[model samples]
Target: MNFKELGISEDIIQVLKNTGITKPTVIQQESIRFIKEGRDVIAEAQTGTGKTLAFLLPIFENISPNINTVQVLIVSPTRELAIQLTEVAMKLKEAKDINILAAYGGKDIGSQLKKLKGNIHLIIATPGRLLDHLRRKTIDLSKLKTLVLDEADQMLFMGFKNEVEAIIKETNKKRQTLCFSATMDSQVKKLAYRYMNDPLMVTVKKEEVTLNNIKQHVVETTDRRKQDALCKVLDEDNPFMAIIFCRTKRRADNLEVALHQRGYNCEKLHGDLIQAKRERIMKAFRNADIQYLIATDVAARGLDVSGVGHIYNYDIPENVETYIHRIGRTGRAGETGYTCLFIDPKDQRTLEEIEKTIKFKIPRRELNI
Candidate 1:
């Protein structure tokens, strides 16, 4: 069904149409009614299932107008996700008037404090940084009508349980709560029910959706010749924007350095860098100042960017889920995308497992170089 049938306003629906999203995904279709009805919701869906829009659409639909005293608080696990959410919020806000602040680590607290003094109706933030604001009394949550925990599993996985509890305790007890997660692990469920007043659980599970839109290839190469193999593929393809998935921070760092020496424009993203630097690099990449981003899975969680044409697996993920998630970064918003996965002799077993899980034999592509 279309978003308009789901009771979304013409302005928001028009903005989504401009972005080329016409139909509502299953998660969006199921969760929007509950959110609009003012029920606490725990939604479980896979990556790339359009979970962001599900909560965002309803939040915007029910936002109390013109009060401007932090009516909504959305907690994210990572800085990248927070920024991405802000971008989405801005799109809807542009259609109307909603003052928003993205509060995360590595930003200047003084600047955030100054912004807090303004008419901010919503604050999208990371748990630690949000708690810091609460401790400093720089943010007011007394008027908060809604609380959203995006990527709930990741927040708990990243060891933010205590910090999240602290933030929840500070918010209005009567506020509506929405927790969105890829998996509803027990911990995530406990958090949802503990603070929520009789929450509703909704799940959208479609295993084949991740592989539906992307063209995938497996390249056979030796471990020592991987760098050269990657260069050949990149040179031949010349992608618009690509994401290279590495296994660790060190590998991403080393791969970026080697690619740069070979006259390729790229950057590495990991937890090791300070948050400010990560934000700057992401901004540059998003603005097309850079064409390639080499990053670990943890560093790229909840990363949603449009126009990503290629995904390269420099290192095979440990499981099928991660492999699917990596490929999902491309082929977004109904666009066909390309993926090239380099496999060494030692990686054969892992490749076989991934193929088994997806139930499709990834075709082998040979390079003349």
Candidate 2:
């Protein structure tokens, strides 16, 4: 079902639509309703399950834009995750008048304190840094309306149990709690049982789909001839939509120009573009207005565009994991996918390593051009 069917507000729904998030994940669909009801929730879902939006959307729905006193406190386990969550919050809250802060170690506390002086409505923080704020009395959570323990098991694993519990104790006792963990171990369950109020537990039962279903082939070509090889494959396959991955931003840019000169409906995405332009290109690509996206690995990470029928490796990835990640972009949600690899003679060793890891030999096709 759509985000609107999950009972979210229209503005956030429009934001999601602009970002090409037209459908909810299984976890989002299952958990959004309970969260909107203000029920304590213990969700079992792995990373990349769209769990962040599941909670963030409902939190936005329940929050007061005017009566802002850190209404929602989302405790993640890492600086990276807190920052990522803050970015997502910023993007989603564009239509609403909400202020957010990401508090984690490695950042200047003074800067955070400066931002905290404002009417911050939400905080996504790591345990240690959040506890620092608590001990210093620089932030007040007495009026906290909801508490989220994201990656609960990871926090315990990282030995932040005490700090998290301390942060939890400072919040309102009657506040709604949402705990999301990849696995509901004994410690996670105990933490939930002690804090949550009759929490409803739900899991996105299906495991992430594998890449084995993606049709794979290797094309023998050198760096000088890779573009011609890609064009040949593009003409041969006529993929519905494809992501042509290049090893570097320069490669992506050159490929975009070459393809554009040949009258291909394509665009390039890399870190060089301004954030606004990158977002606009992404919106266009997600809407299928662009037939091909030439992108660097950095710019295309974590993209979940649906209906991607093919993946083209215009440049051989550095390693097997990178190779897998590139091809894994397609063949999502039970849809069949196709991937073509163009490798030069020098890339044969890396290709062999990848084949040995996946235990599947990539059938090769020679290009006459």
Per-candidate TM vs. native? 0.93, 0.64
Reference-based lDDT, residue 248, model 2: 88
Model 1 scores a C-alpha lDDT of 0.88
Q: For residues 5-81, what per-residue lDDT tens digits would candidate 1 score against the true structure?
A: 88899999899989878899888989898898899999898777888889989888888766768888999998889
Please identify model 2 stretches exceeding 4 Å from their true place. 115-118, 208-369
| lDDT (10s digit) by residue, model 2, range 104-211 | 766665875685575889988989888888898888999999999998988898899889888988999999999998779999999889998999999864236436
Prediction 2 global C-alpha lDDT: 0.84
Q: Report the lDDT of model 2 for residue 122.
A: 90
Candidate 1 at residue 203, lDDT?
Answer: 85
